[model samples]
Target chain A: MSSAYLAAVGEDDSRGGWRPTVDARMVRLESAVEAVLEPHRARLAGADRVTIAPDVHYPFHPSTGVVTDPAVVGAVAAWLDRELGTDLVVVGRSDDRIAFDRTASYLGYDRLAERFDAALVDLADVPTRNEYRAVDGRSVALSVPKPLVESPVIVVPSLRPTEEGTAAGAVRTLGRLVTSGADSSRASVAATQMIDPDLAVLDGTVAYGDDPVATNLLLSGSAPAVDAVATSLLGRDVDADVALSPLLSDGERPVAVENPDGVDLSGVRERLTGGRLPPSDDTHPAVSSAYRLYAAASGDAVPPQLEGR
Target chain B: MLSQFRGRLTDPKPLSIGVLGVGNIGMVHLKSALAMPGVEVLAAADAVPENRDRAERAGVDRTYDDYAALLAAEDLDAAVVALPPFLHAEAVERAAEYGIDVFVEKPLARSTEEADRMLEIAERAGIAVGVDHTLRYQPDMVGVKSAYEDGGVGHVPYASIIRLNDGPLGRPPADTAPPSWPLDPNAVGGGSLLELGVHCFDVLEWLFGELEVRDATMGRTLEIPVEDAATVLLRAPETGTTITLHCGSYQWEELPEVNTRLRLEGITGTITNRDHLPKNFYADAARAALENVASRVGGEPTVFGPTFYLRAHYDALADFCEAIRANEEPPVSGLDGRRSLALAETAYDLAAETVAEDVEVPEVRP
Candidate 1:
């Protein structure tokens, strides 16, 4: 049976809000991360070099629960540096939108790296290697970065739903690292298999439902298993997700959290389910259609922003 | 000095124009100049090659990689200084050297001191300096002003204006890396107050003359170097209106739906910009399209009306061109821009004072 563990910080009554103190929160996050990963300590200790891939697709303020809090990554790095004495790297990729180093600096990763003695590595700069992995029935090929392929990766994803209404879990986070010619869901599954991250630490300190909520919990386990639980919690049907279905096709008995005691799992589900990112596109289809019809009849130039995305 | 330029202004064939920056707003001004009847877009310059390409695509006659080179090469009546705040002074200075009048983008300079120096240079060079403060040109604002002047709402007691947009860090599926200058205090001078509130100050003064800054506050939603949000209280003595103006760069703004609110509370009722705006944008756009089509079918001059907000930008630029052609002072002159900057400086000073006072006070009871 697939198992995960949850370690929540702060009291049940203290859950309504969070203080904006990063240093204090990092202290709690370090303890919570330690607790969640305690069972898999042996697996982590055996790996010589480690890399963390966090959900930092944008430079959204961490307090908004839109990106993984740099403090969470710092806490984990601090633990690894002290306990395992492993050379650590925090990895993200640069896209056409924004450079990874700029995103890191804006989101406070530069300072966090300095404090924890870890290197912030943009995977886009690293040399890449092509690898093939079968996910579901397709032979998907992924050109993953050399650093991620060489090291034991621990995916640290924030608790949030993507624009497509699926949980932007460990799988999709890993999917962003490599270049794949396949559709998003297929690429996600292929990338996750090739990397086979040793663990996933979900930073639920502040979770994004329809808005941000201070959940202040950390959950960790095998990347796929943890993601399965995450999808279920987010009210996303596992079968509907192309990325999750292939990875969890074994029907691993409903996630049995080894230490879910004292935490209201049902309450967490109720709070975060039915959540989605804000609309991030051009004019609505109805509006666009009306404008197009008007333009055809009037010979008026269409506004560029309202034109085809 | 004025007599020397009088010959050039009247002997003008078509008013020759050059655009200094072809970024977002720069392109708008460039397109407006191109569409104008008596304006000839001679050349355009931008630091970014892509922006220069866009200007060329917009059908400009020439493109220059540097504004200084363009100013030196092009013999033009007027130039549009659409560069960032830091470059505004330098661009104007270059135009002044060429004896060319300039229409500068908002926040006329990094500070009022910079603006004063730039204006002095223009004064000695015998050139006109016009500021682009477009809020006063928007249809809804025009409607509000017309109604208030006609006493549609009797003596106004209080008023409030709010302007907000996603600032340097834009909203949503982040597509581009936002320019860094806007968030840096040194590069742009202050934040939301200068970025947006300058327009509010100009428009407010246009409605209710000469405002006195009473109290103000500034805040930041993020850890950026500059304040993203600012609120100021002012008293317009002439109109006896107590006004509250709040401008922020922290709010997410979507296209087609802007976040600018202006309301006038009077003895009888309230006058709001909402009443002037199109109730349903799509429906109104369709109506405007129909009107334009009918005008075309009838062989009548097309009004090219509606999309009223963007039309304001075109109108603002057209007014600048007309001012240059007539050799008359611009509707919004360099002094108007300086006045707005001075008011913003006052608000900043008052806000700092409030903070100092708060820190100085100690608790009496232990």
Candidate 2:
């Protein structure tokens, strides 16, 4: 029986600010990370080299809960280095929008990787292999980075909604890391199935709902099972989630979430049910048109900004 | 039309204008020139075909992929130098060869040295140089100036100004690539200090006489190649006022409102730019629009009436045009622009010193 393990990070008593320092948060996250990683500790420790994949899509401020915090990754690194003494590598890909190294540096991953004696790798520059897997009864081929498949992997994804109003979960984060001709849903499903990651850690320290909600919890399990749990926490329908439905336990929606902290799941679901990224366009067209008409009728001037975008 | 160049017998009446670089700010000047009563936008130029197409859509007669081509072909009284700071000197030099005056977008030039060289060429060509330092012309700043002059705040002490925005790398879900020039110190000269602090310097100098940099600091929030944040301590000897100015490109700004705060603390009370802003921008804009239509004769309709900050750009260009028509110096001349750059350079020097001072020196082995 697959289960997503949940652990509540202990409260910060020593410091507070707009955000706690990464080191401070890392110290606080140690217990939670240890608790979640306990189940797979032996398997993870035996791996020659472990790769940690994170949602470092861009350097959006982590406080907004859009991207995973470096502190959480730092905490995981500390745990791995201390408990397993395992060699670790943190990975993210560079895209046309921004470079991986640039994103890593901005998110403090460069320093965190160094502090934990882990190598920071841009998967874009790494060797890749074509892997074909069956997802939703169709073949999906993905050019996956070699490091992801050659070693045990742990995916750390933030608790947030995509611009398209879907949970940016473990599977989707890993899915986008590979090159594929398949549609996004199928590609992501295929990527997860092909990689068969050892663990999926969901960073819900500050979960983004209609706005950012301080959930202060971490959940870990198999990629799809953890994503199913995340989907539930985000108030999403598992059967409605085509990419996630195929991976979930035979007809069981997010089988069993073993919450060690007994954190109220209902209250969290209610708060984070429907959330989306900030609107790209700040000003409305109607306002500009109204202002333009008034400017025209009055023979007064409308600033170019007030005129139209 | 080429025969009517300023080198010949060009009429300043209904000033013939060409806009160089149809980027965001260039488009602002282009539209302002198009809408102004005594100005005619004859041509526009940009290296980007899409930008040229945008200018054509905005109703310019001719568009050139190169500004030099526009200057070589158009018989115009003036050209608006709206290109990147790296290209300002060349753009102005090209405009000068045709004996055309110029209204340049600020910082005027990347550095004081570049500004001096550009101004020297304009002087030799006998062309008036106007810089688009629009902060002083903003309504709130104007109101602050009016009240300060009226002794609303009997000042005996301190002032502060802050300007912040999400520069080229806007906030998420940011999907586009930020321009390379803004983050390149070699191209832009400096980061937020050069981009935004100069405007604060210009406005502060307008309010209080000349300013002296007392201390300064620069910060980079991201791993970008430039300082995204800057703070400067300044002393105005003439006004006996000490001021603090902070500006940054690290913020996530939204439209419909801008991040600019100017406050003067005095013996009597504080005078803030916020006090002058309309309580409701839309209502005020609607009211202004309706009024502009109601009174057609002798009633000055606020240009860029609905939006306050952009109105400053329109007014700044309009003032430059008025100065050009009258055969006088621009209100914010190239010299004034250089003065702001000099202040920024000094702040940079002081900031560098602060960084040096942070380094530990081994005490001599005694």
Candidate 2 residue lDDT tens string, B1-366: 001112232354688899999888999889888877768999999998977888888889899998998899999999999998899899999989999999988888888889889999999999999999989988889888888889887964899999999887788776776667887888888999989999999999999999999999999876678889999999999999999999999787867678899999978999999998888876876676666676666554556666667778887888888788778898889899999999999999999998988677889996
lDDT measured at residue A164 in model 1 versus the true structure, 0 to 100: 86
lDDT of 1 by residue, B1-366 (tens): 011222233444888899999887888778677766667899999989888887877679799999999999998999999999999999999999999999999999889999999999999999999999989888789889999999988999999999999887887557667887887888889999999999999999999999999999998765567888999999999999999999999777776789999999999999999999999986886677778777667532222244766667776777777778888898889999999999999999999998887565666996
Model 1 DockQ class: acceptable
Q: What is the lDDT of candidate 1?
A: 0.83
Chain B alone, model 2: TM-score?
0.93
CA shift of B151, model 1, Å = 5.2
TM-scores for every predicted model: 0.85, 0.88
Q: How do the residues A3-31 of candidate 1 rate in per-residue lDDT, one tens digit apiece?
A: 89888865534445555556776766766
The collision pairs in model 2 are A298-B292, A298-B293, A303-B304
